[model samples]
Target: MNKLLCSILLATSVSFAGLISTTDVTVDGVNTITKNYQFTPNPADLGDLSHDRATAWGISGVSLANGETVTGASLKIENLRNWELNEWNSLFIDLLWWAPEGVTTYKDQNMGYGYGKDDDYFVGKESEFGTVNLTRLNYNVFSGSDGMYANPSEGVTISLDGYKREGFNKIFPLYDVTIDFSDSELATLTSYLNDGNFGLGIDADCHFYNDGFNLSLTTQKTSDVPEPCSLSLMLIGLTSLGGAFVIKKRK
Candidate 1:
């Protein structure tokens, strides 16, 4: 009995250690799913008020089952370049979602007359300069609204001064920098995901090119249960201990 109990204890400890080693429980362990999206537009498409300008891409391929909750999220911007020489330029970024009676949507330049672009230009519908419930992630100098959307009480600004141009034709590429979402932002994203509508928009004040972008989301189930591997280890330990007791009784 003493040997059996020792064996079980050792097995349980090893199992838990193995589980902790392989999983980040803080981020919800194996329940996390990260999706990367590419957003390399034509150089002319961005940074130009005329010709090809302002673009929005819908976030797709995210499938979460009922009761699963979004715990964390992030956005990765790659190789953002500024065209101005020795002058700081600002890039506007918006997190877009569908809302009833909402004024924000992606508009193309070829949409014709009366379809003028918004102040932010990237995530706004024709002539509509602000988002519905969503907010701008980056500051918009042109709007002079100080990062607030049409709703002045909402929204937050993320500065990218590190990537801005410091000299003539200077390019500061951000390869590994990831913008982590706050708790409130993650909650908003969860709501958007629940509603089946989400998008990311990008627009630059001066000549700039965004090499690409990647979005990541991590989610976990509401119920807390032991992982499969840990459960298996526990079961095996119990089985072994049971067999040992049976042998002792027979002897």
Candidate 2:
């Protein structure tokens, strides 16, 4: 019985650690461009002066099983062409989730959908983050506003310099921005995942000479495993039944 219980306990032991990454950037809806700049400072009517532009990227199919929790979430964005590291002071990044505004799926990447920034240049369809004005757009950050967020008040802001990584041949720098989710925040996130509505949004705030930058989201998930004591008790009950069966057979 003791050996049986030991085996059962060992079999039930669980450890948690896994990461999910999606690069499906070719899809038009998944990759969104918001032209927000109203007027060009220089070049004098060469174009519409649409210098104020940003990108919002989302990763669908995010889910957490029973007893699982999201440990962390981060966004990796490619640096602008010919932009050196010293010019990164003006850059900013934000992480967001789909608000519970009847949004069943994350595939809605249309121009007016919640993915794009609501400004004079473009308009968003969903009301998950309210209007596209600067007040509603800027949330949980000291500076820089890209798009509207469901709960901007409930986000963690970090320094961009801390998560920077070098690309191939050190040509382009990949910036990693981590999102710190609290206990309550994790609960809310899990609820969304369980409901089959896992959609994460990433907003980048910077001035780029061209629209060649790339964005992606990476999230780590951990499951809640049963305690050792609980498993021990369950194994003991099963072992007792086995012992009784052996006694009956001997009799």
In order, candidate lDDTs are 0.44, 0.31
**For model 1, what is the alpha-carbon lDDT of residue 226?**
75
lDDT of 2 by residue, 1-251 (tens): 01111111101111112233322222322332211111111121111112243322223344454554454433222222212332221322322333221111122222221222443221242234211221122222222222112233334332222222246533332222234455555555555555543332222222222222222223333334556687799999999999999999999
Residue-pair clash count for candidate 1: 0
Task: Give the per-residue Cα lDDT of candidate 1 at 91.
Answer: 48
Q: What's the lDDT for residue 5 in model 1?
A: 11
Candidate 1 regions off by >4 Å? 1-52, 99-118, 122-177, 224-251
Q: For each candidate, give its TM-score against the true structure.
A: 0.47, 0.34
Worst 10 residues of 2 by lDDT: 1-10
lDDT for model 2, on a 0 to 1 scale?
0.31
